[model samples]
Target: MSQAGAKRKLQLSELEELRNDAYASARIYKARTKVFHDKHIVRKSIEPGNKVWLFNSKLKLFPGKLRSRWNSPYQVQTVTPHGAITIFDPKKGKTLQVNGQRLKQYIKDSVPTEGVESVTLADPIYST
Candidate 1:
């Protein structure tokens, strides 16, 4: 019947409209989430002569969770303009170029007694 055909077309249009709305909402949500993530990201500033740790990404198959993935105390030798970093390993006396994203600044621990203070606690009296 003509009425049945009209009803089917209306239902199809409504379904198409719902799909379009869902797609638009998804795009908006993704854009907002990206902005929020970008805002919270801390930028790493690495310079020459600063000590940094290198992240090893090669161990993928059987990487032990307890083992540290970062190789520490590598001195930064040079920083290229295109974000490439050259680091020197004192133990091996070798220099290698790597991506800047894999490096994080290494902060040396200060003297153990510098910020530590002795604390004294009094015994509590028991009351019935």
Candidate 2:
């Protein structure tokens, strides 16, 4: 006897079980994240008091005014082992905390030399 045109593929439930097993067998695991606001350099170590500026993502800086942009400058107040960074804002003279993924270090070229860059954050405390 010969078995021809048999359905060989696993069912959806079987596939799901295999997928779960994959998740369980993995010794080390991390989430897959996309690099958008800032470049993510692998194997790079970040220390405290390293001095980083937050990139303002909502405001685009003009001659005398700040336009729509994203990310803002925030100093690194603290860095946890899990990569959580506590940032301090000089504009409001307050301190806030955020995750590493939520923040992007401000490059010198991104900021204007003359006058204040102009802080246009929606809230004093950064929510990330």
Candidate 3:
């Protein structure tokens, strides 16, 4: 009976050791994954007077895949050291503070030319 009890204690100790090893392995895996994810992150350079688009992440009910999720042409007002950004909405005539991660640079399209050229088609006669 004493020998059987000793064997049971040994088995419990081995099980505890296996659990500790699994926890250590999980920690190492998480650390490596975090390093890999942070390395691939692209940092955006945002400054005052730059135009930016705001990501509309609040639409949870009816999220349309074809519709654009970004709201555009918000002029940058100020940038805080902690990634907080202030943008001016010209149409709303107000300024709003948002996170830098939700903002992207907005590039304006080129202006269309006013000059128009008219093309006339000539009738072609085919003889059999």
Candidate 4:
């Protein structure tokens, strides 16, 4: 084959296949390392069934369990497309409608772990 012929050898289908493979790999990676701040995670509009941390405005209503930064992770059951998300509260065993802006995605460290914050690394040493 001539040099010019070889230069244009790649078919359009090959290019599309490569793109699809890349997309699939990225989806898998996202599903695995979903460890990031809420802002980054919930950026491109959220969908129902996605897990998110419901923020607590009132300190009194907030659980005194352990993680005390300001968040409670809950599974989303409904999304309002532009307004709200209905979250399922495992503790209450019921779903509650809440505004999206008040929610945060849960993170393990650098923020606080769920209910395990108070019983921290220091507890092992100072236990009575």
lDDT of 3 by residue, 1-128 (tens): 99999999999999999999999999999999999999998789999999999999986568787888888689999999989999999999999999999999998777665775767788987999
**Which of the numbered candidates is closest to the native, going by highest TM-score?**
3
After superposing candidate 1 on the true structure, give the runs of residues whose Cα lies further than 4 Å from its correct spot.
55-70, 77-86, 93-102, 107-128
Q: Which lDDT values do the candidates have, in the order given?
A: 0.91, 0.61, 0.92, 0.73
For model 3, where is the 10-residue window of minimal lDDT?
A: 110-119
Model 2 agreement with the true structure over 51-89: per-residue lDDT tens digits: 565545334445335443444566677888877788777
Question: What lDDT is obtained when candidate 1 is compared to the true structure?
Answer: 0.91
Candidates in descending TM-score order? 3, 1, 4, 2
- Give candidate 4 misplaced runs (Cα > 4 Å): 1-44, 60-69, 107-128
For all predicted structures, in order, the TM-scores are 0.58, 0.40, 0.67, 0.42
Residue 116, candidate 4: how far off, in angstroms? Answer: 18
Q: RMSD, each candidate, Å? A: 8.2, 15.1, 4.8, 14.7
TM-score of model 3 vs. true structure: 0.67
**How displaced is residue 66 in candidate 1, in Å?**
12
Which prediction has more favorable lDDT, 1 or 2?
A: 1
> Measured by TM-score, how close is model 1 to the native structure?
0.58
